[model samples]
Every structure is written in structure tokens, then in C-alpha cells.
Target chain A: MEEVASKVLSTKPTLFSYFRSSASWRVRLVLALKGIEFTYQAVNITKDGGAQQYSEDYAKMNPMNRVPALFIDGKCLGESIAIIEYLEETRPDTRKVFPSDPYLRAKARQLTEIINSGIQPLQNLEVLNKIEDELKGDRKEWAQHFIKKGMNAFEEIIKETRGKYCIGDEVSIADVCLIPQCFAAERFGVDLATFPNIKEIRDSLTGLPEFIAGDLKSQPDYVA
Target chain B: MEEVASKVLSTKPTLFSYFRSSASWRVRLVLALKGIEFTYQAVNITKDGGAQQYSEDYAKMNPMNRVPALFIDGKCLGESIAIIEYLEETRPDTRKVFPSDPYLRAKARQLTEIINSGIQPLQNLEVLNKIEDELKGDRKEWAQHFIKKGMNAFEEIIKETRGKYCIGDEVSIADVCLIPQCFAAERFGVDLATFPNIKEIRDSLTGLPEFIAGDLKSQPDYVA
Candidate 1:
């Protein structure tokens, strides 16, 4: 069963991904939440001398040259938030990723963007690489600073909105975004204890089957 | 009429914004497109010994401490994308920002995120200040690099998706996102002539009153 699950492929819905790319993981979490099956095509972002995402072929798939571009519904889509929202819209019958109320839905998106734009971009491979190249600053330190700042903001907002998750009792798109960032924070050596609400939210969501399915350890290309 | 319009305030969906914050401009674009009247309250991101957004008072309104927090629907919503999405959902009677077609809607959002997450966050005042402080790198050059790279990707996608606007004949959230980034690109000395599709999109959108109302010069606090 492990072998079958690990090597599953054949173009049902293809996800071009790097196993630990949190952006990619966010999409995977949504797919798992929706009970969707997909072919995992690893695009080893850190391998091959210069990040394979920069290749002409990958650029054609996503001109942005980033990962977790889901080739579903007869078209390829990029941007994890957009792809997640698309999945929510198209596969509403399974489990809804967004809340039904318009305000709650917007709040969910706000929390998602806080991580998406606020934290993830600041610490991602590209930006960290840029910092390392341009300033020769401590890349890990840079990542830690921004992650801590963003997490502080996330903690502040979640204090008001969380209820076993980022929005309420239900797991919204915000929770879908939260788990990956919390993983990123820990990987970057951030003390999650400083962010009690976020840590609490992370603790609650990590045990779920959907989130577990998309975690770093579960991916086909994961390396210890 | 000019006097009334310029000082329009007193409990009509307040917007806490900086004139030059592109993120803030995005929400303003949507409001103008929808013809929604909003009371503009400028939060000088560069004033009063630092950004007013960092004040204890303002942080209560927005934990993220960023500009363009909109007070509407009897609640204060931060994160420009969240506020805009909220406006779109509640005020569907106005000029629709997202398309009815699911794929196109996703595409529009994809383009929005490409700017929202990809470009804007990379070049915003906070990130630039970080770059300047840590590396002493030419901040303009840093901004230009990311802006050009993102615009390159945007141009590529729009080449396939362009009509009269980013997705098709009608305007979209993509177009809302496009105009501000174009403004930022030019500010950072990125020659838009290279990205003809984006340039054309910008040219077409800039002529509309909606885009103009949200532009840098249109705000109450324009300095130059």
C-alpha cells in the first residue's frame, strides 16, 4: 500500500511540485481536504545546478516558474492561493475550504494572504537566495526575522478569530495556509512557543488526515 | 463639488491608506469601479517618526500594521486582497471584479496573486527598508530586479490570456492588480516598453475614471 501510494501517477490531475515547497504544500492540503486524487510530478527546485523551475519547459507550464501548478480541468493553473480557491470553487461538494458567510470567507482569505504574501514570500528560497547573494546577510537570520514578524501578526489576528482553527470551529482556507507556515517557522528555528495561539492552532490541525497527507514527511521526494 | 469630494468623510466605509501604497490603491480601484463611496483617511506610512500604521491605535484596527485597512460591513478588515474580496462578494451588483466563469476567475486571481504575493511584497517599503538596512544594497536596483522578473511572467501569461484586458474583453481583478504594479515599475525605473502586453493593458486601464481615482495623484495626501 505504501509503494502504491508513493508511486501513484497517470495524469488524473497533475501537481508539478517540490516536495517541501510550502506553497506547493498549501495546494496539496486543499486537494487532500477536497478528497481529490492527483499525479505527483516532482520538480526538484533545489537540484540540477540552478533550480529546474527556471528551465524553459517549466516556464511554459508556469511563466512564474514556481511549483504546485495543478494541471486540472483541461488547463494548468499557477499561484497556490488562486489554485486553492479554484479547487474550493470547483469541488464544493466534498469539504468546503472557504466559509459560507461572505465576511468569514474574506477573513479566511485575509489570514491566507497574511501567510501567502506576508510571511512565505519573505522567507522563500528565491528571496532568501536574493538576500544571500546581494547582502551576504545571514539567510537563516533573515528568514527568522520575517517569519517571527509575520507570525507575530498572525498570532495577534488569530487571538481574535481562532476556534480550534484559524476562523472558527470549522477548518477554513486560513487553516489550510497555517500548517505549512508553522512548519516553515520551525524549520527556520523559530520558537513557536512565542506564538501561543498560532502554536495551538498548528497543534490542533496537524493531526487531521488531510493536513497529514500533505506534510513534508509524506511527500514522495522528501529527504531527511 | 471639489470641496465636498475632497473632504468626504464621516462614517461612510473608512479607508486607512497611504497615497503611494500600491496595495491600498488596489482596494481603491475596486471601490471606484463599483462606485462605492468610501471615506479616505490617509495613514502616512512614512510619517510621524515612522509609519503611523505601527501605532498602538492603528494596530488594533489591523494586526498586520499595513495600510489600506477598510472599515466596512460594521467591521474593520485588513489585508487588501481580503478587503477587496469582501467588497466583491457583498457588492456583486456593482461592476464585477471577478468573472462568472470559474477558470477565468481563477486566472484573474492568479494574475492578482502574481502581483500581490510575487511583486508587491518584494518591493514594498518594509522590504526595501530591510534591504537597505541590512545590505545597504541599491534599493532601486533591488526593486527593479523583482519587478522586471514578475512583469516578465505577467507579460507571458497575458500574451495567452489577453483580450481588451488581462482575461478577456472585460476588466478583472487582474487588471486592478496590473495598473498599480505598472505604476510601481515605472517608479522603480523599469521600462514598461519591454512588456508590451502589460503596457497596453496599463494604457487602456489608466484612461478609465476608476483607475484614475485610485492613482497616486488622486489621493488626499499626494506630496509632490
Candidate 2:
């Protein structure tokens, strides 16, 4: 920790995140895997009606008012995928989010999208509240439904693409998205028994030290 | 049409699209801006419960079962942001989806996410149907609400980011996501008068011949 902190002494990146945020976890996994040092600034999304994210000061940095905004390279970056990609582009390392081949890169990205755009937003905290309060729908059940449906597709993609990871041998962005989403799914009581492919890949990823460190319960701000 | 066909003799891209699909339109804008020739295959998402996107054949190509899956470089790509980034990466030319600078690239992508994930999925056809059939909510009102909220954020981002286009004088992927989202918002009865910055940027992009060619009514599959 001392050595890593010394290396990142100049303008250390600060990640504004919430402990339970799946998107923040995605960025955390990437930063960990890339071996980049960053400071974690916990933004409690459950407090003050998520007012921390929407406060005038925070909104100026990320107009979307979402956590997991990375302050790096002298600018603030919002959106987990965007922040990860920016890190990948600016700070290139041995491990990459996308592979070298264009087709394989597309494959990794396709999987990233399956979670980033396809599944996550439908079951985001805000959307779930809308379902429960305004729509009078069971938020948990609605979340379970989308997670199951998306996991089905994700498992199929994993079945076809997996080797040591979600796409071939490397740990691409797909694995980063997969781990957090599975965590979110389980929280909503989604049955992962049928998604053996996703389970297998996730089992492999979550075992890694970096993956373990980035888990929801392991964060500095996490509470029972 | 014949001349355009002749120009793209070998390995022309096939874009699975629907005339009114905002996600599909997003990819369309990028292909057009980059002058990358592609054949359009309309997968009528509004017909037969979006079955065309879910067909075994299409699912094999894109497991997420969404349109704007680009069959290019001998592979299929889904998710508009991912597809556009792939194109930007592979088809490196003077016309790029993001600017040359890394920070600027992050800025472009931040706007892209602001629309791609923030707004579109909230007002997606499936979500709208869910709002109506399951939630017993007025779809139009719901669409308007989300779109307006997102656009307000979008307008702020645009105000800070815009030059001649969304990011700068050059057209970017931010513009690509912006045009389609504004188009979708208007369709859902979202009045654009409040979004002067977005309206101005859309006005500039829509005036170009390439952008005009990518309009909803101009696509080969348009009806009514």
C-alpha cells in the first residue's frame, strides 16, 4: 500500500463511489486489475434521497449525478464504461479491457453492452424505486426478471466466448461487468442455478485477489 | 443506389435496424458520418413483439437481441456506443467519433453515456410497454418525464461541451447519440423548446447530407 501510494503521488485519481453501486464496482475492478492507485470517495446513494449525487457541487462534476465519477488526468469523468475506457486508452498496460483484434474487441464490447446498457439500467436503484412506489410493482421481482433474462443472454455469450475468462483468455470489460451484476442479481434473489456458464466465469473471476478486494462488503464505506 | 452499391463491392457491412429505433439510428449516424458504406436490414422491432431481433439467426449474431448489430470485419457487433467505438477504432481516418485528445475523448464519451444509458433505455419501447401494461401508467407522460429530466442534464453537458458540434467543430459520436435521442424525445411528445443547446446542435447535424440520409423517413424500410 505504501509503495503503490508513493507511485500515484502526483494527482491521484479520486473515484466518487457508493459501496453497493454495481457501476462503481465495475470501475474498481478495472483500476485494481490495471494496478492503478486511486482514492475512493464514498458517495452514499441511499442517504438524503441520493442527494449527494444530485447536489449542485457534485452535479457540476457529473451532470448525470451518478456515482463512480473518476477525477483523473485533470478532468472529471462520469459513466463507468466511459471512465474505464478512458483509463484503458490513457493508461495502457499489459491487461486491456478490449482485445487486440477488432472482431474480438467487438465481442468484448458486445458483452460489456449487454450489462452496461442492456441489463443494469432497467434494474438501477432509481428505476426500482419507481417500480415500487409509483408503479406499485414488486421491485425485487422486476429486478429478478430482467437479471434472469439478461443473465440468460450473458450465459449464452459466455458459453460461446469463454476460455479462461468471458472472452478468450484475457480479463476483458465483460468480466468486470459480469461480477458486479451477478452480485446485484443475488441480492434480489435471482436464481443463478440455470446460468452455469455465467456462474463458471464469475467463479473464476471472483476468486482473484483484485476481484475479492473490490467486492461490495470489502469497500471502506460498506455497512451491514 | 447502383453507384453506392458498386462503391462497396466486397465485404460491405450489414446493419440490422428498425426505422424508428433510436439505438439503430445512433449507429446509422456514425456509419454515415464516417462515410462507411453499409447495407440496412430492417428488423421491425415493433412487429410481432420484436421477434426479428430475437430470432435464432439474429440472436446468434447478437445474443442481446437488439438491432443495429453490425455485420462487419467478419463479425457482429451490438450496443450502439460499442459499435460506434469499434467503427471509430477500426476505421481510423480524419473523421473520428471522438477528438484526438484523451480528455476530450472522455468528454465525448461522457455525453454519449448521458444519452445512451441515461435517457434511451428509460424511454425504450419495452420499458414504455411495461409502464403501460404492468404499471398502468401513461407511457407518453412517463416518456416525457424521463426524456425531459435526461435532456436537462444533456442540455447542460451540451452547453459546456459544444463548439460547432457536440464536442467541437468536428462531428463526433456524442452528436451521433444526441440526434437520435432528440428524435426519440420528440416522438414521445417531448417539446424541445426548453433544450436550446441540443436543438442547436441537432439543427447543425441534421442539415448535413449524410445526416439527412440517415433520417427515419429516409431509410429504405420506412413506412407511413
Candidate 3:
């Protein structure tokens, strides 16, 4: 533990991310909450004709060909939720993203998965593009449907769990996941007004410096 | 910890599961691997006009209206990964599902997310049904495409990390997640021949009693 911690402490981190990618924003938020400064290496997933994430180098770093891959301790890690949990585990002393109580922690994770797996994956860029280009479907409607359905559940869960944040005032992984999904929700034209609880939670968290630092607009590669 | 564990130990668990739901099977595998006995309360997701999961009763337990909501310690928990993590944390003395080493644990989680978020969600029953019914898209083609794409990434990551299991000789959450996904992959007509590493690992793990016990065919609600 000491050896690994010392090695991690000595080396700065590098985040490979995209400005509008919700998953990328999740890792950025975690890094902000942890106060772990790192070099930001942007991977423009939408710019190139084929997307930079599909390039050989980026694919080598993340076989999933996705953004928000963290290069830390001389190793590359991908997957937003996994990277968030890794940060939480390694730096426990930092702002804790998980709850201290067992049930609350489980609830926080449950809420996080509502966004991570339930909402975000369904409306991700790859899925949306596939729906439009190949499936000849309305990508906007598809994204809105799933996002609204997920937010309905998320709103329900948070209504019982909220106290200023998703899990009783602490800024948990649930909150980290929520703010980005809400961004995607509005982009898809989903009416956030339908989910009052989610709207309230999003409003409360977006003003925090940690969340602000992770906002899509504050990103290094932001366009428009 | 003692208070929670004692409460948990005093009461037997009840798993609300579907016969072939990949997410539900994940929690079953964890419970089996941990040697925890739980009552199987089958919630048929396919029966009647609407799935039982969407019923008012089940929705009260899990607003997501998903199967495999584990009722344990006097609380209902949803999200298979969250339930798995809760079990791991609350019962550390049981047969471990996460790797002890920090980095290995992260890798295990990364691989799990590759399936949990990347692959499974894309090919899930709801997504497939939606593609077929509303979008008029070829659901099988959609499932096959996402499953194969995700398997390609899953195979790539495990190649660097595999050693009898996803992270090492011991079975980890990665392996638990992989087995169910392979089940879905085969169902979607994804040839296991392409992902030999995943196939090999899946083959090695399925013969174990714990996995077999969690097999869809082993479920109370299994049809065929």
C-alpha cells in the first residue's frame, strides 16, 4: 500500500477527455473533488471524420475507444465510474464521493448507476449516431425518452435520499453523475421541469467550484 | 459494521429476479460465490401485457422497475453492481469477489464497467424491445453490433490482465460480470470464436458450482 501510494503521489496524472462527453465530465468532476491536478489531454471524439477516439493511439489507451481515460501511476485507466471509484479508493482522505454509512453508500451507488448505466449509456454519442445514421431513427426522441425515463427514476430515488445532495448533503458519486446527465438531458431537449427533484439537485450542485471546474464550458477544448 | 452485518445475518435475503436477466444473474453469482443463501423471488419480466417489474408493487421497491432487486437487511436494493459492492463491503470475511490489491481492484472494476455500462446496457431487453417496437429497427442486428463491439473491447483488456481469471488466479467481479455478458452475447449470435480470451475465461469459470448455480437455467423462473 505504501509503495503504491508513494508512487502515485509522486507522479502527476493526465486526463484524456472530450468537452461535451458526459462520461469524460464525470472523471473531471471526480478529479476536481479529489483536488488531484493533472495534465488535460483532450481527445476530440467528434472532430475528425472518424473520431479521434477510434485512432490507433487513443484506442490503445482505451480499447473501448472512449474519452476520459486517466493516465496515472504510469498506467492508463478508462470507464468513468471505474475511474471515479479508483480515485475514491486510492485517496480516501480527499473529499469523499461515497457515503460513510453502508446503506447510504449503497443508495448513492444505486443512484449513480441509474445515470451511469441506465441513462447515459442509452444516449451516448455512439448509440445516438448509430440510431440516426444506421437505424434511421429519431436520435433526439430516443435520447429524450431514455433520459426522461431514467430521470424519473433518479428523481424518485433522490427524493427519498436527498438532503442538499443526492445522499443527504454529501456530494457523492450520484451527484457527480447527475449533473452531467442533466447536461445531456437538456441537449436532447428533455424537459427538466418534469423532474423537480432532479432539477433541484442539479441546481444545487452546479454552483459548487468542483462541479463548475468539471462543467463542459470550463473544459480546455470547449467549442461554442 | 457489526450492527449492519448482524441485522443482515439475522435475516435471510430475498432476490427479485428474472430467469434470464443478465443483471439479475450477476447478483446471484455473487451470492453463490459468497455462500450466502437467499430466497429466489422470481419477477417475470416477460409475462402478461406488461412486465411484472413495472407493476406498482415492484416499482415501489425499485423505481427503475427492474428485476433483481435484493431485499436484505430490511431494505430493498437495486442495481446489480451496487448490490454486489454492498455485499462485498458488508461481508468482507466471505469469499472475496474484489481483488485485494488496489490496482488489480481498479482493473477488475474497469473490466466490469466495460460490460455493465458499455455492453450489457446496449443489448438489454428494454433497449432491444424499444429498437424493434418503436424505432422499427432490427433489434437482433442492434444487439449483435453492440455486443460484438463491447466484447472486442472486453477481450482486449482481459488479454493484458487475465491469469486464470480476469485479474488473477482468484475469481473477481470482472469474471462474474463477464459470464452473464457472454450468455447475452451468444444469445445475440455473437460468435465466441472471435473472442478466444473471453471464451476461454468463460469456459474456465462456468464449470464452477457457484456460476452454475447462478445460471439462467438454474433460476426458478427459467422457461427452457
Candidate 4:
């Protein structure tokens, strides 16, 4: 069994990620939650047509050339939510990140999508950059407007099903998505006071060592 | 076994859906795929401040006031992708919409997210309405720009990993997402010739009886 396992896990997995990407943060959280050992390979996306876009090696790994691509054993996986769910299905014993009950699982995934699809994408670095460059909107104003509107919608959803976490007292995938989005919101100077539930959840999760370890400030690429 | 099964399947499910929402379309696809019958409770989102905003009952089901909320056996589920995944898990035999292999499953999910997070949200009716009402841009030009850009990205992603279907030869959740997005793009006058892979897949799927049955054209509230 050990020999078979060694062959399966032959090559060490490396995560091509950035410190500030919300998508990367979600994958990092999943790695910590699942106790999966992997190397954190940082790609500084702000330099030279973006590191992920220009690097020949990274392009080979992910043709989409997006950050948060996981090179595991010899295969590459892109998309943060998909990568995390892959981990959940394969490593169920490390910790069950998803609820067993289908209804509860749906509720958890719904909240996760609210953050992933609704909030994170609108406030992404690329989108903000586009608005700044193409639309000639002030970067600061564009970030603030999108963040505030997205956070307002997130707050309404959070209020509906939140308990100790984003979904009924469990530290599921929804919490992983929430923290990074809130981090992005704060970076844009969006006030969290108006969203009591969001603030409370963010505060609670930040206190955990697992979440703290996954913070952008603690990543290998952290400048400060 | 029949007694236990009847107890489990006794309750009717409710779905909080909008007349012509792509997200709602995704949930409807899942219901059809799973062979799970549901009560279609329409939330007319274009009249009298939008049914989602004013309907107290709908608000209680999904505080976010988004459509495609599913009430299964008296419990409400929201987020279209999540609801679909929930149906897949509970009714695994009806039609296996997700692959069992973790990596393949992740790829399928990644394709779905590309549609959900990357494409659909940007081209949503509400977002377009807001751009027209608040941003004071030429609505047609803005719509054209976003639809083209988003479809371009979708086409590139699909070209990379698709086979007979989105992920493999089988019909997965990604196909469910792709068809509706293509439907919306055509409505917005996006030139499909530029995206051969997308056009081919869309045309092939649209020809299928299952897809045709689930199409927006077949819905009760379809305008055309």
C-alpha cells in the first residue's frame, strides 16, 4: 500500500499562485484544511505583462495562464473552486469540507457561489484594471463602487444562513471563499461596519491559525 | 424498501425562478437531468420593482433575492450550480452529470465556473440595465462589448478541453451551463462564426432533444 501510494504521489505538487488573489486564497485554505502538503510557488502577476501571462513554463501548465494552477503529481488543475472540490472528494478523511446532507451541501455551495461568482469576479484585479484603462474611471472609485455593491449583496446572503460560519456553524468551502473576498473589499477601503455578519465571520476566521497561515501577509511573496 | 423510499420522496420541491434567467435555466436543467419533478414558482423580475424585490415569500426563500432557488422537500436551495450539484449527489442514477474521477470532475466544474463566474454575470440583464440606467453609456455598445469579450474568453476555454461534450464524451453540468450562455449571446447578436468550437458545441447540443426541451424557448414565459 505504501509503495502504491508513493507511486501515485511521486512528484510533489506545486501551486502557482499569487498572494493577493482571492482565488488563490481559497485553494490555500483548502490545502491547510485537508493537511495536503505542497510547495507554494508564487508568481508575481503585476510584473511584465503579468508573470502568469508571459511565462512560457506557466503557459504550458495552464493555457488559460491564470494564477492558482495546481501541478499535482504530474497533472495540472486550474480554477480554485474546482481544485478545492477535487481535494474534498479525494481526501474526505483529512476533514469533510462539504456537508454530507445534499440539502445542506447545496446551501453551502450556494453561499460559496454567491461569493465566488457574484462578489469576487466583479472586484478582480483584471476587471478593475480594465475599468481603469478602458473606461477611464478612476481606479479608486471603480474599486469602491464594485466592492460596495458586491459586499452589500453578500451581506444580505450572509444574514440569511450564517451561524458560527457562513453556513450553519461549519467551516465549509463558503468560509474559504468569504475571507478572501472580504480581504479584497478591505484593500479597496470598503467599510465592513455596515455588514455586521460579514465582519463577524471575517473576524472569527482570521483568528484561526489555519486562516492566519493562509493570509496574503504570511505568504512566501508577502512584501511587508 | 418501498415504504422507506416513499417517506423520503413524499414532499414536493419548490423552485424560486425568474422567467428568463440563465442561472434559473441551469437549475431547471438539473431538475430535468435528475428526473425530479418540482413546483415552478415564477418570480417575475421585470415588473413592479421586480418580483424578487417585493415578494415577501420569495425573499424568505432566498434573502439575496436571486432566482433559481429550489425548495426540495420543503427546504430551499439557491445558487444554480450548487443546486445542480446537489441534485447530482442525491439522484446519482438519474443521469450522471458529474464524473466520478476527481480530476475529471474538477475539469467539468472549471468549465461550469468559466460560464458562471466569467461569462454569465457580466452579461446579466440586471447588469446591462444598470449600465444603461446609471453609467449613461450607449446600452447597445456596452452590451456588444461585454458579450463579445466574454464570449471570446468562453470560446478559448472551451476550445482547450472539450471533446464531444464540455469535458468528455458525456453530458455533464458544463454542457448545461454552455447552452444557455450561448442562447443569451445569440440574443445579444454576438457573431458565432468567430467561435467555431463554441458554435459547433452549441449547435450540436441545441439539436439534442434533452437540450431542446430545457431551452428558454420551451419555457412558459418565453417571449418569442
Fnat (0 to 1) per candidate: 0.88, 0.75, 0.70, 0.63
Question: lDDT tens string, model 1, B24-82?
Answer: 99999999999999888888888764557887878877888898898887777899999
Best by lDDT: 3
Q: Tell me the tens digit of each residue's lDDT in model 2 across A1-224.
A: 12223332458888888989999999999988888888888888899898888888788777888888888876778999889889889887546877888777877887887888788988999989988998899999888877887788888877878898998988889999999998889889987778887888888888898898888888999999
The regions of model 4 sitting more than 4 angstroms off are: A1-10, A54-57, A138-153, A156-160, B1-10, B49-51, B138-161
TM-score of candidate 1 to 2 decimals: 0.95
Position A64, candidate 2: lDDT: 80
Q: What is the TM-score of chain A in candidate 4?
A: 0.90
> What is residue B131's positional error in candidate 3, in angstroms?
1.4
Q: What 10-residue stretch in candidate 3 chain B is worst by lDDT?
A: B1-10
Best by DockQ: 1
Q: Write the per-residue lDDT of candidate 3 for residues A54-105, one digit (tens) a residue.
A: 8777777789989888888778898998888889888988889999999999
Question: Measured against the native two-chain assembly using Cα atoms, what DockQ does each of the candidate structures obtain, in the order listed?
Answer: 0.82, 0.70, 0.72, 0.47
Model 2 CA deviation exceeding 4 Å by range: A1-10, B1-10
Model 4 clashing residue pairs (backbone): none
The per-residue C-alpha lDDT of model 1 at residue A206 equals: 90
The reply for model 1, stretches above 4 Å from the true place, is: A1-11, B1-11
Give interface RMSD for all predictions: 0.8, 1.2, 0.8, 2.4
Chain B TM-score for all candidates, comma-separated: 0.93, 0.92, 0.94, 0.88
Please list the C-alpha lDDT of all candidates, in the order they appear. Answer: 0.86, 0.83, 0.87, 0.75
Cα displacement (Å) at residue B209, model 4? 2.3
lDDT of 3 at B54: 82
